[model samples]
Target: MTIYILLLLIAMQLIGVYFFQNLEDRFYENFRDNLEKQAGILQEVIKDKMTPGTESEKQRKAIDDILNKLPLDKKNTIQIVDQESVVIATTSGENSRIGQKNKSPRVSRVLQGIESPSVEVSHKAGNRYMVYSYPIKNDGDIIGAVYIEAPMQEMYDTIRTVSKILIKITAAAMVGTSLLGIILARTITNPVKEITEQATVMAEGDFNRKVTVKSDDEIGKLASAFNHLAQHLRDALSQNEEEKGRLQSVLANMSDGVIATDRKGKVIVSNRRARKMLGKDIELNEDINQVLPLANPISFPLTEERESFLELNRDEDETLILKLTFTPVLRASREAVGLILVLQDVTEEEKLDRQRKEFVANVSHELRTPLTTIKSYLEALDEGGAMEEPELASRFLRVTRQEAERMTRLIHDLLQLSKLDSEKVRFHKQPLRLEELLEDAADRFSFQCRQKDIAFSLSIRKPLPRVYADRDQIDRVLDNLLSNAVKYTPEGQSVSLSAHRRSDGYVEVVVSDKGIGIPKKDLDRIFERFYRVDKARSRSMGGTGLGLAIAREIVQAHGGTIRMDSRYGEGTTVRFTLPPCEPEVNPA
Candidate 1:
């Protein structure tokens, strides 16, 4: 509106000024021209009356006659001066002024004949006038002069009136322009204002409010774009939240440790699993070396195709064998921006590999012992010892046979273990009464126990749940347990075989011996093939060291669990469990 007013005011002012100037100029020019024409008429009338012989009074009479006949207003006056520089006649008709000499510079200029028929204008103290001077001539000789003076007050008054009217017109134009400007301003600004307000709401995370479009103009398009942008931002934020949730879930539940780091090797993201694997109080931006020193040697933007492994021996009696993979985050230009480290715990796998190698070595050593002994005895017999001394031949032959039998047993146990490990031995699962198996095993071991003077006992709880197991496999399990008990128990000590129904629908069997118990450290590995606590004693007792291993394998094949618990110098208990059989339903 202000701009409109300014433009209107400026245009109106220029037009008013030009009109006023043109009008004022035309009015002054026309006024002067009319007054000069009147002066010319007076010169003609006065010149015609003037003759070389004509009297001054006659000239004065002629000028006064012309002046009286002239249509002059009150602001206009005329004077006639003779060649003598004297006022001869006046339009005022004053008797004192008719014959007096006019000493005015204009009249003197006319009487001297230096200049003629001149118009001059003057203004002072709000009074304005123009003067016209003409010479009266007879036969081209100046005889007298005529002068007319007219006030410009009426012309100035007309100009002032017109100027007042133009000012009013300009004011009206300004008012109209201001009102139109207001309308235009609202039309353009209203939609913009609404969009700004709604955009502010959207910025505050509210996308409900929509800006109203008033026109199909730029502002309306902006409003439409704003609405779309609001919705897009909302959707993008929602998707971001969903992806964030999924990522968090993966990080929290995954067994592997995930750590994301920046290009500077500063930790950026550390998931819950990573923190738990590292430390619960682990902080972000901690150096990668602090969290995983193995990464320090491998620079970002990995140069190798394969990742490396790290064996972290924790100080808290925990060992972590981690396989580490370093992946570089890249931009569109393939520039390295950061790194992601995936740490997979390989502790169990490494432990199993180590155990397998140790088992192979132990098997070789245990097998070589009996074979080497048998070979020595056979060589002694083949070297004529049997021919030279029959007694020596018998002893050597017996020792060799014993060793051969031990080897046979060891080979059988090895093959059994291999089949169990390969899952090639199928178990025929059926119901086997726990009490019956217990009684049968007790009777079989009773003679051995009596010969050694060791008290043997069987405690099978009545109405025990029938075990779900392979009948032959369970029998071997029971026989192995009782044999171990009898073999390990010293004379005068007691060995008890027991069975009961567990609350969890399983049958628990236990064989306990008051014998030279295994050390606490070796209890966990007592069932391992070729593992022994008293190697020499076991060999002397004709124990192959594979009994417990074979028994465990059979029990496991039958879908049961076996474990051993022992206290050094006190006793050892081997326990196993089998799922109970479903009760038989009788048909009516």
Candidate 2:
């Protein structure tokens, strides 16, 4: 397009210059011809008026009369010279050469009997003059010469005016031509511009868009081609959508969560797994704030140089963990138009991973002690020192038995935990009196409490509500709490077990001890399997550290909850609740 415009401008300039130059030459020629004719006529009048015997005054009067009668056109300057090559008369009221001689070669030649017609001479006035030298002839002899001089300033002036007019016309014509070219260029380039814009939109992945077909010219034909391409692209996109639907179906049925959002951080689609993880049927077009309230806020650092992750806590009241990843969806223009959120439920996976690591470390540690003892005992025996070290051997065997028992207990607890985790353990549910249960559990620990010189007390609110739970699991729960209380309490300190009906119609049992209370930091994690606040003390007291974890699991299985409250160096209280079940009314 630019090339076309440039060529048009160049052609217009050339034509304008040619026309101006031609007009200038023609104007000069016409003016020069008119001046030559006027000079010739003046010379004829002068020659006719002159006679060989004519007196000077009469001749001068005739010359004045003729000159006066001649037209005084603005551009003509007339002068007359006599046969003496001297000034004779001038229409401008002075001798033709008052201060100079008539030095024109044409005048001298005409005086010598050569009848010179009108001729052109360059003058000092910056214009050419046409001089007509006519010989004044008498009876068969040349007498004098009549010279007529007419300056060509009028012709030059006419040519200048015509040249200026022509230049102005040429300039106007060029300007008009340029304007027309601009209009034509717009007519052709506008459609091309529209096509370029449409193509850009398609490149941005908007296949549904098409250009407007406004004409039947080449530009219109290009638009039609672009629209056809858009149609094909739309069909391809439809096919891709079908494939995506199938893929989404597969993802929905899987255990992992799947979530996707648009550029505005609005939830566009989600699978069943995600819905389950969020514990609700999340709808499309919902903002992320409403869909996943517990998830971390989205940070749209599109211009940042780093990627980010969000740890979404779906169930703050339960054990649900969602790991969400944000990835930018870049278009062909390298712009971030949307983001994809991938959610994964890693709760159980993380738990199992922690368990695996702990298991390995625990097994290695558990085996090391026994192996060391066995190695030492066998080494002593191998030195043939059995006779002298029989008593030492007996003590070594006892120590070996204790280590083996510890390993067996650890394995048994691991197996129990596995069963509980897999839901393979059977639970027999029945209604039991809370007071009776607490009494039985306390009785079993009474002797141990006395052995440690610790006071054991039980506080029961009368008419306590009966709880629906597994009897054995509840018994284990009570046993663990009481044992923990006894273990942590100092000798002569008090351990209190209390049962009461909560306002929410649940049976709450609180076992508190004034012992070397757990540290504030360790209170939350005290129920984790193999997590002991005082590891040395727990091991010295023959604890496997799985009792509290098992207790929490069993209580949770019965739809109950357990929590601990403690202040370092003061006391610790372990509280648990079980929902009350309706009592069986006797027949009236």
Candidate 3:
């Protein structure tokens, strides 16, 4: 607006200056021409009244009368000169023209008839004047010259008045033009300002702001387009937020651990499972190196044609395994921005898969041995004409029966393990005295202990707390622990069972053995199905490797915990805790 106003002001000033100069020039030209004409008429009258060659009183009166009739005032002076350049008469309140020569060279030249009648400058009475010279001729002979002087003050005064009017008009016109320019500019710029503010809001991520379009001009069209764009942006941003929320929900509830990192390998986000795996002390924005230093060297392929996995050991004690996979997240430009690290805890899955394979192989081996023995015995009986030797037949039959019993035992253990794996076993819960249960389990294992020549003892603290458990499951649990102790202990070694009250109001039953103890490294995983510290010795003793596993499950179902403390070449203690049952109250 200011620029437009400035341009209008400049243009008006230029036009005003041009008009005032032209007006001044025309005023001066017309004023000078009229003055010269009046002076010429006065000169003709004086020449007509004059007698030839002599000055007469009549001519003098005629000159004075002509001068009086002339429009000469104090601002104008008139003088008459002869052909000799001598002053003949004057209108400056003087009669000294009889001998005075015309000092103006222009007037002298005119009297000599060598110059045209013209206007020139004359100096008189201490003022400058415009003088017009004319010749009075008789019969084409130059007789006298007329000179008129008009002061330039009136022209100067007229020009000054016109100049003042022009200045005032120029200023008024400039002000009016500036105001009009500001109004017009505002009409355009005000809407643009509003659009600019709305654009700023949009840049700051507030897509809901819209610009108002009030006209069909270019600026209005721009505003309309901007509003439409903002609406679309708002919808897209809302959808993006909802998608992000769904992604977060999936990550939160996923069983597998997930960690996401930027291109710089800095941690960007982590799910609950990932945080737990990395330890709760870590937080977002922490370096991945700090959380998984060992796994940092394991890289995953994220390209379209590449897929790689890193097998990570999460627990050294239990051989817990995680499969880490990486996938790339790309922008619309197909630039890789970051990576997604997916951690699948495959410990249980992998263990179960290995167990299935081992079970098939072990079942084949166990059945093969028994079937081979029975087949050999039956073949011997069939080939030897054994009806002539009844004693040999009976022995062969007894051996066949023993082989069949072995097969039955192997099948039973396999079925029990299968039932446990499928969670098909149901337990009946009841309160049982811990000491009595321990005693019964020990008595069932006395025969094995006697064969091994291992002494067994039981220590029951007085007033031992009764435990809430499934009676049959507790019996199996106690039998498993006692039989394991007796089998592992050397001959003449003592295996002891103790029951006592724990500080946390639970009952603790500890079965300790003087045996070739387990190594510290294998203690934590002793309860895993089919895990054996000494595979050869355990199998030689008819161990199915599922006893401790079943015991663990039963204890957990009864709201109890089992743990082992062992030292190599020293001794081992297996302690289990069961919550005490509240005493039944009589009717009060």
Candidate 4:
């Protein structure tokens, strides 16, 4: 707008100067032309009158009469001068310049028969004049000259008035142009400025501000389009954020660790589980091969390949077996652009599978030994001589009965273990006095201790806490512990059962025996099914090797914990704790 106003101002100024200058030039040219024509007409009419015979006063009078008849204004002056450059007649202000020698160069030249007109300033009248001289000739002989003077004050006054009007017009034009410039600026510049500001804000990720549209012009339409584009951009950004949030949620809650990499094999996305499984040092843009535990290195142009199980040994106590599944992320063109690697920790599953195999093998081995013995004895009795001797046959049948009983015990233990594993066994729980249960178990194991010639004792702390447990299961647990203690104790060794209330609100029952204790290495596996430190001695003594495992399961089902503390060649102490009964439950 300002530029427009400045351009208009300059144009107006140039045009105004040109028009005024031309008008002044034309005005002066027409004034001079009219003055010269009038002077010529006066010279022609008075030329015969100003010839040699006429008196100077009559000639002047004749010129005045002619000028009066020619409609000349009072501001004009005409003079007739003779051959001597002397003024004869004057019409300026009634004989003001009469009988005066006109010494002007123009008049002298006309008297010499050369006519010329020139401009000069009159010192007497203090005015500028356009002087014209004309030679009065009679029959080609110069007789007198005519001198004319026209004052230019009126043209000067008219030029001054026109100049003032032109200045006023130019000023008025400039003022109006400035006002229009301001209006145009408001109409156009303001909206463009608002749109630019909104665009800047949108660049900085804020799309909530809108431009105000005041008109339905081009600028307003542009602003509307900008607003629409901003809305679409804002929606697109919102959807991207929501998708990112859902992806993060899925990755965080997934059981398997997930890691996503770009085509360059740099990690792009990793979740909490992935970081935990890998390590805290795992970071975005890190090389996937460096952090991931894979049996083989990852390659570009990844394929849908499952790597072999990789072992991650954190410590001696904890080892992890992870299965890595690599899946290539493909675009719609079926081009592999990245990779998604999933890590599944299958350590516990692998351990369970191995245990299942071992359990099956052990069950078969346990059943086969007895079945083989019974088969061998039956075959011998089937021979003719063996069946004919009654004593020998009775001996063989007794051995066969013992072997069958061992098989039955093995099968029963295996079934119980299976029930525990599947959580199919339900406990019928009730409140019971810990001291009475200890005494009952000690009495049941008394005969076994006597047969081994080992002394058994029971110690009960007074006011022992009662426990809530299934009576039959608790009895079996007690029987397993006592039988083991009696069977392992040497003759003349001592075994003790004690019950007490512990500080952590549990009833602690301990069975300690001065027997050949377990080795430190075998202590950890003592509670495992079919695991025996002395396998040969245990099998010979009619042990199924599942007693301790069953005991642990029953104790855990009652919400208790069991542990063993044994020193090689010293003694063994097995202790278990059960939660005390609530105050509301009456003791059984």
Candidate 5:
């Protein structure tokens, strides 16, 4: 900007100097031309009197008269010369070079008619002069020459003064131009500087600053665009951050584990669940193939698709059944940018489904057996077996009734279990003395215990906690437990039912027996419907296999827990708790 200003100032000064110089030169030229015209008028006045027959006095008188009458100023020294090249008259008065021979070469040329009257500057008497000579003619014949000398010192002095004024103006103009140019340059440079700083800040990832718009010009528009661009970048960054947060939130909260990888199969994103479900050592920004043991997980999909499930045995106790869904996240150009792997844990669902299938088969088998038995007996009765042996026929009829009863009990228990599973069983909850309930349940099962030669006993601790529960449901739970104890116990073995106050605000009922103890491995599944340690013995003893299952559901519905503890070759204990009713507060 400074350079441009300076150049502009110099050019303006140069033009001023050139124009003023021409004006000065032209002024001097007009001054010389005026002098030549005055010289020609003086020669014309005397040329007619200077005929070859005329005397010098007559021609000189005419020249003096004409010079006096004409407007030729005294700045020029006018003199008249004859063809003899001698001065005849002068404007300098009589004492000024009268009857003197002219010594100028240009005056001699005009006398010889070798040149026209012309003007030239000469320095004489310490002053510069414009000397002009013209030929005096009469009747188309040259007679004498007239000479004029104009002093140019004063004109040059005036011209120098004018040039000085012009120079001053030009200098002022140049200085003004420089100052104005600097201001204009700042208009461009200052905004540019600001924009540069702002751009630098933007490079550092800050788009919050804006350039100051000081004008409505192109530069101002540029600043506006820059600010807009900065805002756009900020919005884009914010949007990206929001999207990243949303993606991470979704990944974290997803029930299924998720892993995303780059085009190179490098794990770019993973969640805690993914790490836990895949393996504890799974790390991000590592090769997916290396981090997780996969057979061919890196076979990236050419398009959006789903693959088969991949099952991983995470540990001895848990198997992670993951349905690995492979999908390609493509760009607008239809190029696969990366791969997404969805890991859905199906361990529990699969286990329940498998259990359901087993339960169906077990129920079918249980139902088929009794039906088969009844069918065989009825067929026998219809085949005239009653006529062959009355005792045998009576026995067959008893067997049929027993099988039918078993079938009815199985069906009833199955219906009860279905209601329990669906949570459709309504309860009539009320406070009841748990010890009294225990005594009643024990008495009901006492006869059966005696028939099996199993000793039945009840242990009730003092101040036994009263439980809030459905009476009918609880009585059934007690019946099932006592029946199992009596049927499974060896002959003369003791089965005890105990009620006590547990510290956790509940009444605990423990039905324990020195019976055929369950295997240790089967304890985990003891409450599952239709699961029995010894199925043959259980069926023979009229065990429907849904007793413990029903007991668990009823106890749990009352906000309690039922647990079974058993050891192979040792006694088994099935204990359950019922929440006690809240104590009533008397009004103060």
Candidate 6:
């Protein structure tokens, strides 16, 4: 309040100064204007009388009469000089200056054809005067000039009196304003000071203290609001604690790892899952870059991206692939406060997704090859010349029929695989002679082996156990293995099928062949659908790549296990085992 009063006083003082200065300037301007008007009139009257080279007493008397008859003030003087610098006329008692070289510089300047005004002190009277001078022309020649002087003492005295009165008024206003401001400050500042003290206590975490209300005005309302704010702060802190507990519970049970960091990338919160996934317990306020595997340090003042993702593949005891999702924590104003990182293990998912893409691509390539061949052959037959030649047309028809058959086989294999994948295939399990199934597969492939001139052999160990298995499905598995053995074996190379009883009371069947073997790198994916060691050779021999995959599925369904071992450029061996049927005990 005091400061405001001081500012008001300063403003009043500035206004007083402005008005005083303006009044002084106006008085001087009016005085100069009056002198100019009088000078102009004098020039008109005397220009004809101011003749060059003329010194006449009658001319001087005529100018004096003209000056005396004018309505001039008592403190004003007017004089006229001729071209010879001799004063020709004067008003009242100034006739002593006539017929003399009136050598005033201002008057001489006017004689040279310039009109101007100036203020100077009168040495004799000790008072300031306004002096104006102008040229008088006769026949376009400056034959003489006129000079006028007016006293400024009266105008100065008036301005001085106005300034003293204005100063008195300004001083009185400042005194009155200061007294009122002090009274007002007593009412407002005391309440405000108390409220400020209460606020300071609140800042120190003491919300129990409240401001005392002494009046029912705005200050009283402010005190009431401060008390309400303290209550609200207490409630908010309690609710915040409850929410914090719930968040901790959720983080503890979450499957994915959760981590939170402040704006500087310092860890503020972490869960057990996050610690386990990172393989180290992260401490609070630790730099996030030190915890996560990063090729470059995370830059500060993080970018305003919506979110980000990172894939981390760490090869420690085993290959571990994690998908990390980063999201910024923001305030209501969309200001970033921190960061949230969620880690998910995606190793199996990535592997399965890759396999699915490969499966689709392989299917498209396989079907397109057969369909393209069929289309070409059919188009050839449709051309006029090809059908007219009987032999060529027969060959085209045969090739088309063969490709159609291949497509049919591919479709059938795909359906069989689908059923196996869904667990919809029912196995008619029974105890059967496993040796007889092996023998039948060898005999079925004997004709193909004879055509290829590959040696085929079968051996059944003595005391071979009867196994519990499916007849048709087991036959299918055996047929697939024997066909692959014979197909890959060179002419004169031997292919053998053997069945024996294992020490673990299971029947084992072994299919061995001296064939072009699988490479070591591809051995792991041998049982995957449509995975072939040699795609062109397999397609040419009418071999669907699903053979080995389907064979493995069938064997597993019959309570058995199947595996294969091969060395590049050497022989290959495929083996399987079926759980034997428990011996039937005699009924008690």
The candidate maximizing TM-score is 1
Candidate 4: where are CA atoms >4 Å away?
A: 1-172, 207-256, 303-308, 377-398, 421-437, 463-472, 503-506, 578-588
| Candidate 2 colliding pairs, count | 0
Q: What TM-score does each of the candidates earn?
A: 0.82, 0.47, 0.68, 0.68, 0.74, 0.53
Candidate 3's residue-wise lDDT over 133-220, tens digit each? 8887777777888887788767778788878887887778777777766775666788788888988988899887677788888888
Backbone clashes counted, model 6: 0
Off by over 4 Å in 6: 1-255, 269-286, 293-309, 312-320, 328-337, 583-588
lDDT of 5 at 112: 85
In model 6, what lDDT does residue 337 have? Answer: 86
Report the Cα lDDT for candidate 2. Answer: 0.75
lDDT of 4: 0.83
Q: Write the number of the candidate with greater TM-score, choosing between 2 and 3.
A: 3
Predictions in order: lDDT? 0.80, 0.75, 0.77, 0.83, 0.82, 0.82
How well is each residue in 471-579 modelled by candidate 1, as lDDT tens digits? 7888888888888888787889999989887767678899999988889778867887777888898878888778898998887776679999888878889999987
By lDDT, is 1 or 2 better? 1
lDDT of 6: 0.82
lDDT of each residue in 464-569, candidate 2, tens digit only = 8777888888898888889888988889898999988887777889999998898877987888878888778798888878888888888888888999998887
Evaluated with lDDT, which candidate comes out highest? 4
Clashing pairs for predicted structure model 2, backbone only: none
lDDT of 3 at 414: 66
Evaluation by lDDT, superior candidate among 4 and 6: 4
